[model samples]
Target: MTYADVFRAEWGQVVATLIRMIGDWELAEECTQEACAAALERWPRDGVPDKPGAWLTTTARNRAIDWLRREAVGAAKLQEVAAMTDEPPPAYDVPDDRLRLMFTCCHPALAMEARVALTLRTLAGLSTAEIARAFLVGETTMSKRLTRAKQKIQYAGIPYRVPPAHLLPERTPAVLAVLYLLFNEGYSDVSRSTLSQEGIRLARLLVELMPEEPEAAGLLALMLFHDSRRETRLSPDGVLITLDEQDRTRWNCELITEAEELLDRTLQRHMPGPYQVQAAIAACHAIARTAADTDWPQIAALYGQLPQTPVVALNRAVALGMADGPGVGLALVDQLATGSLAGYHLLPAARADFLRRLNRRTEAVAAYTEAIELATTDADRKYLQKRLVQVSVQS
Candidate 1:
């Protein structure tokens, strides 16, 4: 694999190892970046190392040892890092060091948003700006939050490992939230698709680690279902492709089947949670022979089972429109508390779609224009622009 490919595959493992050795989040990250950069520059000359992960861990740990010695923090820390081998010994039975780190980062003491943001930054190697955009916040704001979170971990001495089995029940929700947000960030942004893939990989690890946790299985199914369509979400020219317009023939059937079977297995446990419910909804779409065959009413019912957040409510409205008529959908969308969904581009985009369906061409054009303005990503903005042009012509 190329240096870039190797970086994506092993960044988390290398970071986890350094953190375990140095016990400094910032140092581990910085040294890991330096080690990866060294690889990028030197690999072409020296040839990619046969064991890039080992090479990276040695390079980064050595850097950390050097930094610690210069600062003279403690002989023990220097000795600890200096004596590290390629692999850091796990304190417990955690299968992967990265998973151990994720649980620590998602400690319940941190605000839910802070937990998700910190884990994304430390484990997935997302830049502060990238995490900020994912959270819909300014870069400076996210930077401060991350700083505070790490400080909290340091000062409070959050254990850098999986919680005890007794604590896992309470902490499981927060850990799941981190993975969900990480996956969502990846799913939304093409540039960071690797984050989504990493999220999936980690979720799989969680499922293995806790076989009885239905929600973990539920989450994995949800990710696989969503990722199955990744190839079709954007067109060749990079314009967004709506579900109905995507080519079913090219969808990843293997992923869909895996997700569906997993969801089925999890549902049999009879512990229905939001993730399972949402995965079931996704499965409805996946099983449809065509867009025309989608079970909108069933999907709408599944949406109703979820907590009625503004986004969920908006989606339910869309499903209602599809199941009933655009008029019903438009009415529900309009009935949402005004300003509750303010500045959420999808709200306007949903309105535009419902309006378009109702042949309210003038309203559709205006809504699409508004959505285009509010849209954050280029693909979304382009898709709205296309819709605006179509509706404008119709009007």
Candidate 2:
């Protein structure tokens, strides 16, 4: 693999290991970056090492030890680092350094937003600017958020290891939520593909580490199901394609089959969670040969089982509209319009579709215009703009 690839794949593990060894987050990050830079300069000449991860770890740990020595930070920690250097790298195992790092970054003590941001920055190795752009915030804002989060971790004495067995049930949800958001952000905007893939990779690791956790498998299944349709999500001209309009032939059957298998395994456990419910909904869509064949009723029922967040309620309304009538969906949309979903683009977009289906051209046009104004992503904006033009002509 190229040096860049190695750095991307191993940076988090190296940092996590160094943090565990040296108990200094900043020092770990600094040493990891230096190790990566050294690899970039030396690998082309010395050739890639037999074990890139081990090589990087050794190099970074050595750097950390040197820094510790220079700082004169007591003999105890220095002795720890010196011993770490002497020991051979352990064999690859189920619960790797990255998984431990994920749990640590997603600690419940951190705010939910802080958990997501720190996971993306530390585990996924995304730049502050990249993360800022992904979340549609300014770079300065994201920088401060990350800095504050890291400071909190240090000052609050948050342990860097994975939670104990009793704590896993309570802690895993936050980690799963962070992964879900990371994948969603990437899925929504093609520019953030790395985040989506990183999310899947980490989710897979989580499942491997905790096979008894059905929700972990469910989360992975949900991501795989969504990823199966990635290629068909947009048209050649870069306009967003609704699920009904997408060419099903272009969908990745392999990923769909794998996701189904995962869902089946999780269902066998007889423990349904939000991720499992969402995965089942995705599976319902995947198994359908055409949009008309989709099990909207079943999907709606699945959504009903989920906690009624504004977004879930909005989605349920759309499914209800499809299964019942546009009027049913429109009534639900109207109820949400004055609530917390007032400014959400999808709420108006859903309203516009329901109105258009009911042949209320004037109302549809208005809703489409509102949706266009609030649309966030380029794809969403383009799709809404197209809908606006069509509805305007009809009006």
Candidate 3:
């Protein structure tokens, strides 16, 4: 059971280390996966090893050694890999190699989607399916994308290390975007919480490494605020709980406080960005003592400050609907029904809520049905199913 957690935390390190050593992404992955399979078979009988990462790394190294011998790549390289031996890397203390690999994966040579997807796949060990869900695409589509990205790296001879200091500015934004997307995956899904925590951990490292970057701090604050309520986001029966219905008393005050303090420092920088504005919106909900106390008008105004992407427009619509009247919100929501959010469940979910609030029970029922039909997670489906029943009876 604990091995699963260790694997999530260590998989990236093992893979990254092997890639660094052998310079073959595919072979490193295969050997590390083989090492994982070996652990599953042995750990239960032999008991969990004291140093799992070291054990796995050594096992993987030996596997690589055997592989190189069979492949007959080169005598010198084979001797080199075989001769390498030392203390295994630490489990958690600021993995430089993994960070280097992250920057490498975020190289501008690849498409933005491919860079983020590849980084999540290689550095975080997230499944292609998980990354696909985050991207709102099919698993097969993402698999091909990942395969192509890796092939691009291999054939194009992109270096697998961090960029120089001068090049960091251009790549930093992409890196931040990847981290934010990673955290959101965790935030929206319960099963991937470890990935979410990894997102936070890496964000903290980025902030520490680049304290001058206010947006990095802002991103970290955003993650903390959302992660604070993780425990209360679901009911005992695994039903999704909306933010308004969440038990605020059970929220982690410490994380919220840390986030607020961090955001305050970020604000002092006087260079507000999209992440800062979004963090400010999260702050409003966090500071409110009750759902009724939430500053919907202020939140709506904050959302207005952001660039009006389809997702942002949808969020603004919800905030406006909450701040003004249901009519105002429903109008905005409806305008987006045919655009980029055509099949997105949240759009219909928001429409259903506004209609429900307006007592348009029949319309609400239909909207809820659409939302539930499109929803992916069981938690979302269950919550929408409950809403559908309520609206149907009312109609």
Q: Please report the candidate that would top lDDT against the real structure.
A: 3
Point out where model 1 deviates above 4 Å: 1-5, 164-167, 249-254, 331-341, 373-378
lDDT of 1 by residue, 222-264 (tens): 9999999999999877789999999988889999999998999
Error of 3 at 176 (Å): 1.7
Candidate 3 residue 322 Cα shift, in angstroms, is 1.3
For residues 1-395, write the lDDT of model 2, one tens digit per residue: 45676787777777877877776777888999999988888988999988898899899988988988899999999898878753534544436555566776688888877888888777777778767755556779999998898889889888876666567666687788778877887898775677689889989988877788999999999999999999999977778999999899999999999999999998997779999999999999999999999999999999999999888999999999999999999998888877767667788899999999999999898888898887768889999889888988877
Model 2 spans > 4 angstroms off: 1-94, 108-114, 125-149, 162-170
For residues 1-395, write the lDDT of model 3, one tens digit per residue. 47777887788878877776777878888999999999999999998888898888888889999999999988887787676565554443234555556776788999988888988888788889878867767789999999898889889988876667667766778789889988887778787787789789889988987788899999999999999999999899989999999999999999999999999998987678999999999999999999999999999999999999889999999999899999999999999988868767998999999999999999899999999988878889999998899888888
Residue 389 local lDDT, model 3: 92
Candidate 3: RMSD over Cα atoms? 2.9
What is the Cα-based lDDT of residue 60 in candidate 1? 88
Candidate 2 lDDT at 60 equals 91
Please report, as a residue range, the 10-residue window in candidate 1 with the lowest summed lDDT: 86-95
Q: What lDDT score goes with residue 4 in model 1?
A: 73
